[model samples]
Target: MTPIEILNKIVQAESNAREIYSEAESLREGFDNYVNKEIEEIRKQYYERADKMIAEAKERETARAEAAIQELDKKLEAELDAAKKHFEREKDAVVLKIFKLAVDADA
Candidate 1:
């Protein structure tokens, strides 16, 4: 080949290599963007599920505590009623005993 033709072929080959490199770099950037967006969406879904579970647990605990309080109130009311009935049955005897003690002290 002539010297001038040989030089032209070398320049053409270098230009083709540069174009291939640019195309490969652009494709790599596009793939990276796609992966990052997918990761963000998955993270968002995971947090939402966790929040739902926490709210459900709180509701169940509140209901259990309220039920325990109601049972305690019922027991307190029954004890108070029994005490009232016992006092009513013994009040007259207690009053007569005090009156007899007062008369003996005066003598």
Candidate 2:
């Protein structure tokens, strides 16, 4: 071949290589974009599940706290009722003691 023909062939080969490289780069970019989108979707699903779990846990904790409060209230009410009955039983004795004290002071 002549000098010009050899140089032309070399230029054409380089041009084909550049085109192939560009096409490969574009395909890689598209694949990366698709993978990124899939990752984002998976992350979003995970966050939603986590949020639901957290809310359920909070509800359970609140129910337990309310039960504890109710139990404590029942205990306090029982204590108060017992005190009232005891006071009632002592009322007459307390009044008699006061009466004796007043009579002795007068004497």
Candidate 3:
């Protein structure tokens, strides 16, 4: 081939290579976009799961705390009842002793 003809062929080959490279780049960009969208969806799902788990855990903790408070209230009520009974007994004993002393002095 003539030198000019060979140069023309080289230019044509280079142009075809550029077109192929551009098409490949476009396909790669599209795939990357698809992958990013899928990743975002997965991340959103993970967050939703985490939120649900956290809410369940909070409910469990609240139930446990309520049970503990109820138990403590029952114990406190029992202790108060015992204290009241003891105080009444002591008051009656002291009153009887004072009455006896007053009557014996009069005698």
Going through the candidates in the order shown, the clash numbers are 0, 0, 0
Number of the top candidate by lDDT?
Answer: 2
lDDT accuracy of residue 58 in candidate 3: 100
Lowest lDDT sum, 10 consecutive residues, model 3, at 86-95
Worst 10 residues of 2 by lDDT: 86-95
lDDT of each: 0.91, 0.99, 0.98
Model 3: CA > 4 A from native: 2-5, 94-107
lDDT of 3 by residue, 10-75 (tens): 999999999999999999999999999999999999999999999999999999999999999999
- Distance from true location, Cα of 77 in model 3, Å: 1.2
Better of 1 and 2 by TM-score: 2
Most TM-score-accurate candidate:
2
Q: Considering only N, C-alpha and C atoms within 3 Å, which residue pairs clash in candidate 1?
A: none
| Cα error, candidate 3, residue 80 (Å) | 1.3
Residue-wise C-alpha lDDT for candidate 1, range 1-107, written one tens digit per residue = 99999999999988989999999899999989999999999999999999999999999999999999999999989999888898799878878889889989999
* Model 3: residue 42 alpha-carbon error in angstroms: 1.4
